[model samples]
Target: MRDLHSNRPLVWSLFAAFALVTLYMLGVRTLVPPDEGRYAEMAREMFVTGDWVTTRLNGIKYFEKPPLQTWMNALSFSLFGVGEWQARLWTGLCGIGGVFITAYAGSRVFGQRVGLYAGLVLGSCFYWVACSQIDSLDMGLSGMMTIVLCALLLGQREGASARENRNWMLLCWAAMALSVLSKGLIGLMLPGGILVSYTLLTLQWRLWTRLHLVKGLLLFLAVAAPWFILVGLRNPEQPAFFFIHEHWDRFFKTEHHREQVWYVFFVLTAVGMVPWLGMLAQSLWLGAKRAPGVDPRAFRPRLMALVWAVFIIAFFTKSNSKLPGYILPVFPALALLTAIYLDAGSRLARVISAALTALVGAALLATVPFMPGMAGRSTEVALYQGYQPWVLVAGFVSLVGGALALLYARQMKRDLFVLVLAVTGFATTQIMIAGFEPIGKARAGTAMLPAIEAQLAPGTPIYAVGVYEQSMTFYLRRTVTLVAYTDEFSFGLQQQPELAIPTVPQFVERWMADAAAGRRNLAFMREDIYTALQAQGVPLRVVARDARRMVVANDVKQK
Candidate 1:
């Protein structure tokens, strides 16, 4: 009872620390990244237009992904008003929820120490930190996947009491259905694929009989199928494009034309697991040697985690279109595994922890000179900028923490590892926030929206000459018309030669014809194109010229 009481505070402290870190990371940034902006804009558009059926970017059909994330964003916008932070709030909340759920699951599978460690590892993982702060669908899917997986694992532990496990199974189905809603088929496919493979590989057939497969399938379909079916009926073109072209063909035939060699994922995976890679390796190595049936419950959970990690890695590795975030679901599994390994107090675990701490120290030290522009700077620039001084300070703190942790471990300590991991994670989180300063300060193209908006009359007929800026379209909340010259440039000469402007004489004739009809013509052109029009003596005046775009209007007053 005394031991239990002592453990309670430590566990609560770990939870509190992780929660603070997650909140700090989430609170620091505006949605400046590519996908976040796109999603937020889409949601805002949806809310304003009240058209949830089809998604439009720049007022054109954008059927690239399903509507779940958009719907979530729209709902958020409705509740919180349309803003960058509000758009990203749900993802952040999901991320925090994932950390807690993973910890709870870990506690059930192993013990309190393992659970605390798992939560710490997960909350601090660079992948989770970065991905969770954004407005992407991947993190949502990842969170849902973690919850479903934990529920399933916990249900499996109920053992022989079908009634008790039923609720867990039902939760799994519901979570999985949410996953599918979050990111399409892979939510169901990846988890189902991994579980089946693990069961077969480990000869755990009895687990299958316990799963109540029929009821679970019905639940999944009941929850997930409606949206797909409704969306399919509404937009007949989507099913072929999404399931076949995006999923199957993109993987098998390189339809999206993103083919990388298999070893690329190994590099990506290493980078993705940063700061925890050493611990992960040690966990897998130690886990591989555990004799069968020593603790059947422990053995199964670890086995499931291993299979989860392997299956996600393997599945994405075999795909033609590989992205860094594709394997995010594997992080929770790795965290659980690492937590379990850390709890054992093995010499190997301590060595792994020490090595990882050293690497993190080096990394933090390296960031000292670069923090100012580091977040916004390209990778090459960040590296060339060297470490920032404050980053160095953070590094020194982490280094001291890590060294003390190693010393504590040598003396058979546990909490020090958690402390070091938390400190390092906090430092890394700060570094990431510092890195965003330059990007936030840098003038994103959205800055020009007000200028562009001011220039337009109630219906001045806006048109792009040789470019289509999605950011402009998103912020402006209206589609800019695409003129021949601009369309050619945006689509490129090879794919859209028809968009090329005819000769000067031909352009003048067309301009005069439009002018004769009293049409107020405005064309956004490149400076070179504007110069060419002036050279051709087609009476046009520059309305505005930025570094990248030049707005031109026909000189009706001169006429």
Candidate 2:
């Protein structure tokens, strides 16, 4: 095999591409569709309180997820201050790291040409781009797992010395621990299942002999177990409920997120791969035919990659609950396969690449005019909100990028094509951040914070009548009390019955009592609840209203 670093220019080009994608995604404003605002606010809470043990939303106990992501956000906040950009910095860095790791791993396993292709594909992937920009835990987990898998693959193939192998094993365990910190048990579950299945299927069981399994397990347990234990000890119900119901039960039951059949991931996979979908399919087919003849000792990395792709798809497909992001970890393997397939440099490969570039370019071009209107609906801002200039800029950049990609494809210049895609993606993302997002922020629940504030007197108790918006909480800088009007809907009311105020009768009694005492009460209610109150003849005056929420103040003059 050629010396991977001998092609320094190509490697640098790949790095530049990765950097471009990272910057674009990171530069964009925290968008809707994935609850970026909620995650960002939680991080703000973490930074504000400095308490690492328990997670809070709007200053209320929020245990929906573990603390690792919030910790990363808090660290960024401490250094960069609280805002959308700072909140997403860590996720962006992890995304860039994932791209490089994929490239490096490919180079080691399949040579430099393949590594460069792999990096390009991963960097330009739409799903990767979207996930990288958001303040979600999945991207970080996917990136860490990719690095660990690559390290282990390289170790298994090249580590002749015990010390070398041990070092790799330790790195793998560390990555696993970090994955656990990112999203809980599924982190360890997906990677561990893939490795175990690959080892058994490839008859590389003896390789486990070199893994120092006991030490690796101990290390993982030491790092990951303490947090779970402490969190569980602090909240006793968490141990059984989170591990059992949220993890196991949620996987097998549709109680959390139910959708379609098990094989629905095929659609997700295709969509996630986007422009590279055709190439990914070809790569997987090529891998299946060639994987068996490769030496188990020498070609184990490819087999491991296959296992990673297959196991994740299988595991998630079988789960009763599924989301688009759940299949993210499998992408690195698909990327590697696509890179190998593209490395042949055949006329057909170039054509496929050209097609992909054109498709993405077309998609971007089509999105421009609609972008501002789309922003208006999500943000409830006027359709002409200051996003037109940015949208035009993004459109122009996409045209340039598409043209560059076509030029490179015609010239058979793979590196240049990669660079063009990266540049375009970055430019489009920047337009979104600087252009489209301000409109979104103006319409997002965050926009209502000032109005809510104006209505409240100094230290007036604000309450979320039946719903909570994490973004609203962050902006308000205090926890809004939750008043449940129904047993079916009130949050935190089941465990703490004292907080439950079931039925309009209950709500009326509380409001009347508080008002009678000359105390002002402001309630944030969802549209449905406000309507329900109206239907019940509660005489609730709507001080403010929006698509999803309403603010009602009893005795409006009191404030």
Candidate 3:
């Protein structure tokens, strides 16, 4: 394989292409339900209320996770305005930047081509690409973990200057600190645990001295502990909720109601890595093979990476709680392994990878025709109809890229083969993901916002009766009163009792009082809730309706 380092243009091109695909998708789709809208709203509230200490959801105390992501997101809003793309910019940048960082660290540790391949594998990996395009803490968490892992690898290299070693170790500690800020303590726990286990496995007690524990610990404490300390001080209940309930209880008990079968992550990581899973296994097997080495004290980067991946999967698997993103920290290590494997220039590996690409391309193409049939709802099917052409474009790009990869492998052009698949990754992400805008639109409840907004005059209190559309709170640019509806926000609402209207009767009484006081009120609820409201003979008039939600107003004349 030709050295990718010689061609600055090619490197820049890859970065540009990946960035464009990821950034373009940020604005194309409305923030989807639950996660996207939830995080974005959290950031929005932080920006609105100027309360960076205790993170809030729907104007209530939200203490499940730390505020690092929310802080970055709030910073984004301050810089770019309160738009979708702006909210996502931090996560998108982290994903793109993580690719380069992994490549840089890989090159420093391995060689140039291996580094390029590392970036290619990570940037284009199915799950990484998907995570990068969304506004989630996972990518941020993944990126930060990559930094910490890479720094540890780079610092522990065989023969670096003492100054260089200390600097790298310090950076590693700092990145771990930021990692804590990114998601929660797992950021430190996962990687730190990996380091301890790897050290024990290698029997390299001397590696401990290289860690620069004194300054590193101080640096980590300085960056990571402040927010927790401050937020806990401000909201006394938060320390218990975040440290105990969120981390410990979430791991030990399924009290949060997110328990899953033990093998879920195994399946998710296997499917998530997709075309690269075979290479990942191959890399691991290769790592486990003992090389003929006289120096038993030698440090092993692959061993470190393998430990990182294994520890994350094992720790998460042992926990009572699980999510798809919990396994994201494993990809960096897998990408590193694949890069090393690719660096060895295995024609057979390239051939197999290309074949997998072809299979995946075919599968993507195959899904296009049946998309409408797949969706049970007409609105969703209509979204599929509108989104079908772009899916075909994605399929065509992926197919062509795969076919080109096969030809490159046939001709022994491994560089072109990898490059083709990489571009296909970028294209698949851009087309297929951005193409889901219609679906996002449908689920986003944006269509119903206009009518809902019209009925909402200045200072008109809006009620989310028996339903909470996440994006609506952000769209309305104010917190909606929850009338007998608190799902995820129940914890926060519990902490702040005044923030919600906990019962249907309470809402009715409040609505009647507000109506009698000559204050117009509007409500958005599910169709079932609207039916129930009608059956109860609620005075609200239906102003607008969508497939799932209805907007009702006290004054029919406004509609």
**Tens-digit lDDT string for candidate 3 (1-559):** 4666669897888778777877777787789877888889999999988988988888888887788889999999998899898878888888888888899989898778888889998888888888887888898898888899899889987777798899999999999999999888888898779988998888888999899999999999999999888887888888777788788898999877878898998898876775566566788876665445726787888788888888999999999888889898898888888888876746777777777877777887898888888776775678788888888888778778877887998888767777877777666766778888878877778888777776666888888988888887887788888888877777788777788888888888888787777789988877877777778877778877766677887654553
lDDT of 1 by residue, 1-559 (tens): 2232147776677567666666566555555635766777778888888988777554555666767788888998899787666777778778889888888888877777677778878887778877888888889889899988898888887442667688888889888989888888888898889889987777777877767789999999998888778867876766776787667876788646667778776777676665667666778765556544566433277778888888899988988888777888888888888888777747656756666776677777876654555444353354324335545765776677667767766766566656576567656656755555434423235545565666566676666665555445555666565555432123223333444453445555666677677665666676777788787777676665554556666754633
Off by over 4 Å in 1: 1-17, 20-27, 158-160, 289-299, 367-401, 440-443, 456-468, 477-479, 482-559
Q: Is 2 or 3 the stronger prediction by TM-score?
A: 3
Best by lDDT: 3
Report how far residue 559 has shifted in candidate 1, in Å: 16
* TM-scores for candidates 1 onward, in order: 0.83, 0.87, 0.96
Candidate numbers sorted by lDDT from highest down:
3, 2, 1
Ranking by TM-score: 3, 2, 1
Task: Give the C-alpha lDDT of model 2.
Answer: 0.71
State model 3's lDDT: 0.83
TM-score of 1: 0.83
lDDT of 1 at 515: 67
> 52-115 in candidate 2: lDDT tens per residue?
7877565555565677888888898899777777777878888888888898888877887788
lDDT of 1: 0.70
